[model samples]
Target: MYYDGIGTEANEKKGFELMLKVAKSSSLGAIHLKHHAQFNIGRAYFEGYGVEQNNKEAERWWIQAADDGSPNASVLAQTMLGMLYSRPDFLNLKQAFFWHSEACGNGSLESQGILGVMYLQGDGIKQSEASAYECLKEAADRGNVYAQGRLVQLFYNKKLFTKASDLARRVVAYTDVEELARDTGCLAAYITKGIAYACFYLSRCLALGNGLRMDKEEAEKYFKRACELDPVVSHDFHLDVAYGIL
Candidate 1:
């Protein structure tokens, strides 16, 4: 409780001691403890936090934790391994896809989002816009900001303006840009969707000469904001179309 802050202030020392205690008594707890400890140890090694920085050691511990069925740890390990394999000297696209697929199958939103991008871009897998859309939509629905931005792009490509606008509204309502900036985290998928939707709305407003004056600048700003958040191919493509560049 103290370790997790359930009922008391968080204490890493106490948490470590309690983990050790649990490991001594139950095999399940032991496995979890080992997995968590190795994950933290890997991070420590990777970041040089109270330990000498060592990518190899970090990989080793991450792999051990992954082998122990720690889903998140496995995802991180697989991503790192994939990155290593993707180097010019290695150039193993197949292996990269394999690890990424494994992590995606295990429900890692980051992996899914990356996989979606890869599919969309035909990076390693065959280019399949439909597949990318499906993957991104699933991840976005799960609250991945990156995925949400991609989803907005997908909607724009399909000319589904109403749906896109709805998605954008949801993002604007649910996301906090300041908080995301502080952590350098992606905005919630909905937020990206909302920006795209807002851009589309602005464009429509300009075309119809609604209450707002016909302002290309305002429309462009919204579009730029959407691009800044996600920058998916479809969003860029649509921007070109809207500006007569397509």
Candidate 2:
């Protein structure tokens, strides 16, 4: 409540202090909550909620929480570490890969989706289409939008326009495209970007009658939506279409 003012005035410093106290406490009363406290403290440091932003301190606290053996906190902390190491300022691909792999093994849907991308692009490891397919399929089956987008791209590359169109249709079926585009979290941004990719591909399918009937009006609408979601991506997709890259 103090942190975000759920029912009271926000007091980030007090929230951080309480979390730190819980993290430092070794009593049985605190054991069940300590890992979560540690994770929150790391988040506070990372986002400068109540303290100076310090990536090192964030990393340290997250590592402690990740190793604390609380399944939820451990997985969350590991996933956070992966995201942290992926930042341009941090830029530790190997570390990012390791932490994501760790989180994936712990059944983190986000990490599983990211691992698929890494395998597909060879970002921090050897590229393997087979591994990419496996990871993407697993995550997509479990409703990971990021993995679904990449899988749709894979299908498109393999000339499976029908499958791509089907999946892309599902991805963009939601009614909150504008809200998704405006979200600030990394995962939400990725989801919005993925939705844009899906829209671009779906528009192509409509225009070319590859997997659906040719509908110029619908195609234009979706193409415009792709641009609205992510203009940079839309521009790149437009160039690819121009160059017969699809």
Candidate 3:
């Protein structure tokens, strides 16, 4: 409908009118059509494409689209809803948990990983190690880099070294830590708690060859990476002895 406008002159109003007509249709078997139309309508409002810019209106449409269960729109809505609830300013823990769970169940890898963290730390939901492990494992298995990193930390905390080492190797293959005070996904829970829980126990295994083959050079690499990610992990021999404290 806007094709003519694009070739001649910009006509956002005309585009918006056409989009509204399609979005208002009550026809069946038009799930994708409705979903996309609604999404575009929301975008139009948000971006002032053909209407007055209004975030509240945009969010309302997005929420409706998400609840409509259009696959793509649902995912987008899930993400938007999760982000809205997760914001420190909004801080609706119950709603955040609900939407994140919905998104996770719908295969949003980021939601799965974040939901796992919430479960592990009891931030928004009741802490349940079993649930945490299941969500984190699912996300990690899907090759989400951040999820893989967090899974390594979780398994390491549980003394599941084989699992930890396996995941750590996968993460190291893709990234390295340049800062300790950020969300690289691996140390987020540990950092936020300010307790220095030693997120890189598997790194020591690589360095000391305890259950894994000893490779001092590689150990040193992981040591530096760990320390940069969290200063608490300066390969503190004392923490190793005080393991149960964290």
**lDDT, candidates in the order shown:** 0.61, 0.85, 0.65
TM accuracy, model 2: 0.87
Q: Which parts of model 3 have CA positions greater than 4 angstroms off?
A: 1-31, 37-58, 68-73, 175-220, 223-246
Model 2 lDDT vs. the true structure? 0.85
Please write out the lDDT profile of model 3 over residues 1-246, one tens digit for every residue: 472375667678887887777778876756557766676677788677779988777778777767744346656566556656777766887788887778777767667877887898897788999998888788767644556666776876787777677667656654324343233333343332222223355556675464568787776666566666556444463376469443
In angstroms, give how far residue 216 of model 3 lies from its true place. Answer: 5.7
TM-score of every model? 0.60, 0.87, 0.60
Cα lDDT of model 1 by residue, 208-241, tens digit: 4443466777656665665665567437657766
TM-score, cand. 1 vs. native: 0.60
Q: Which of the numbered candidates is closest to the native, going by highest TM-score?
A: 2
- Top candidate by lDDT: 2
- Number of clashes in every candidate structure? 7, 0, 2
Q: Which ten residues in a row have the lowest lDDT in candidate 3?
A: 190-199
Model 2 segments more than 4 A misplaced? 68-73, 177-186
> 2 or 3: which has the higher TM-score?
2
